[model samples]
Target: MRISVIGTGYLGTTHAACMAELGFEVVGLDSDPKKIEQLASGVLPFHEPGLPELLRKHTASGRLRFTTSYAEVGAWADVHFIAVGTPQKAGDHAADMTYVDGATSALAGHITRDCLIVGKSTVPVGTARRLGNLVRESTSGDVKVDLLWNPEFLREGYAVEDTLRPDRLVAGGDSAAAIDLLKLVYAKALKSGTPFISTDLETAELVKAAANAFLATKISFINAFSEVTEHVGGDIRVLADAIGLDNRIGRRFLNAGVGFGGGCLPKDIRALQARVSELGLDRTMRFLSEVDEINLRRRDRVVHLATEILKDLQGRKIAVLGVAFKPHSDDVRDSPALDVAAQLFNAGADVSVFDPEAMENARKRFPRLNYTKSAAEALENSALTILLTEWDEFKELNPTEVGDIVESKAIIDGRNVLHVQDWLDAGWRFESLGRRSV
Candidate 1:
């Protein structure tokens, strides 16, 4: 089947390349000519593991292409997946639906043949049903344009693997044909016995929101416990392991560090709360407000710890190890690590930052902070060091080697990846979230 994916961002680019790998003719559509040009030449504009190889291979094989014109894709493809971004609105908790709406409307106007329009973007609930009506109203009567919600559940670093081998598939729409088409598109995964969930449009949209909310809640739940352990003098990691052994609470996302932050979790929870409030049932998801607060407070805690350790932040050289929200990806949106670094800088510290892949994006976000070429460069002669995102290189740093470079040997394990005893043995004062300094 011919396929077209709109908005060649993180989700769209990965989906389009994966679709091409499944042996379909795919065209990725975007309004940005520069992004389209980059993809057309098999150059990924962002950092993702294993995606660059796929893009290069597919583009070379003639099965995948990219374009700036929606009209080209609208007339050419049998299925159009809307992978546009639904970023959180500015100064509000609601999702910015401008991209999703604009893409769907453009596709509806330009599609000349019967096709399925699937929504893969994480959006507020009731968006698909509402857009489904928009599709019906906006499309020409000659073509049968239908809408479905098939929200993406891709982890940034593991996006390629997750796309090719998803845990499960969910399709929501009334049309059997639409579901069947999606099944065909995902037939490779189904052949491997991946479970398929067919539900109403609203249920499908909520699956992404609900899953993200649960994860954000899970992270905050543990961090809230971390707050207790911080005061009561207990090991939060051991506590997490004991609770995770229950099987009811899995070990995933139980790592209590600097709290959850990335493109999805923070905004998704806020969006869900905002959505419920707009529906006039504001009390339904009120707990999420606390979840958001706990997450933000973790950042504050790290900054506070730094201040206490340094005994005065002014003119102190601080080294920030990682700025990406999590390791293995360069996305800095709502990144706790980046936010902490910015916070420290604002509080009058000589902050030097380094990330394996995120320094460019981090520089764009916080240009005033000093960006360094490597961890060693950032660590050299610094009074304090903070490990924000737990990248493998940073995690594997030898305490003695790191101590030799730094003027003062004090470290904060923001992601809980460091061996506390090892740092302590190195004669460095070590601190971590939920752990009392010895």
Candidate 2:
């Protein structure tokens, strides 16, 4: 099948490459000329583990390509996947639908033949139905265009794997042909026993938001208890493990760290809240506000812990071990680690930040803080250190080796990936978010 994936951000780029890997001719489309140029040259504009090699290989093999022209994509492909971003609005909690809307309309106008236009973007419920109407209205009567909501459930670092071998597939539309086409598109995964959910457009739209909201709630629920353990002196990690032993509550997202952040959880929760409010069911999703508050407070707790450990922020040199929201990806959107680093820098501390893959993006987002090329450089002569993101390297740091380079012997395990006794035995004062300092 010939495929065109619009909006060559993380989701689109990964989808296009994976589709090409599936033996399909794929073209990734974007309005951004520079991004298109970069992708066409086999140079990904961002960091995603294992994606660069796939992109380079496919671009070299002539199976996958990129272009900024919707006309080129519309006239060329049998399926068009709308993978545009729906970021939270600047001043409000609602999602900004401008990109998705524009892309759909553009695709509608340029399509020369009947094709499936599937949405992979996370959007407010009712978006597909509305966009479907727009497509119907925009397209010529001679050409048939079916809109399907097939929201993507891709994790950042594992987007390629997630796309090729998804946990399940949720496709929403009334058209039998559209559903079959989608089934054909995902035949490889379907054959491997991956569950495929067929539902109405609204349900499919809500799937992404609901999933994100639940995950965010789970993280916040644990972190809220972390706040309690911080005062009453219990181990949050142990508590999480004990509770996680129950099959009902999974251990994932149970880590009580600087809370959930990235491109999805935070914004999706807020967007869900905003969407429900718009539907006049404002109080239904009200608990998400608490979830949001609890997540933000985790970041604050890290800052407070840092202040307590350092005694003062002024003139102190602090090293932030990771700035990406989580390890294995460089997306710093709503990142707790980066925010903590910036907060400390704002308070007159000399902060050095380092991430395995996010230093450049972190610098672009928060430039005032120092960016270091390596973890050792960031830790060099620092009064205190904070392991904010659970990068493998940061999590596996040798306590004695790290202690030797620091000016002081204090550390904050923001992600709780460190051994308290190990740091303490190395003559370092260690603290983590949910544990009492040792």
Lowest summed-lDDT stretch of 10 residues in model 2? 415-424
TM-score, candidate number 2:
0.99
- Give the alpha carbon lDDT tens digit for every residue of 384-408 in model 2: 9999999999888999999889999
Q: Give candidate 1's whole-model lDDT.
A: 0.94
RMSD of each predicted structure: 0.7, 0.7
Ten contiguous residues with the weakest lDDT in model 1: 138-147
Alpha-carbon lDDT, every model: 0.94, 0.93
Q: Model 1: per-residue lDDT, tens digit, 272-356?
A: 9999999999899999999999999999999999999999999999999999999989999999999999999999999999999
Clashing pairs in 2: none
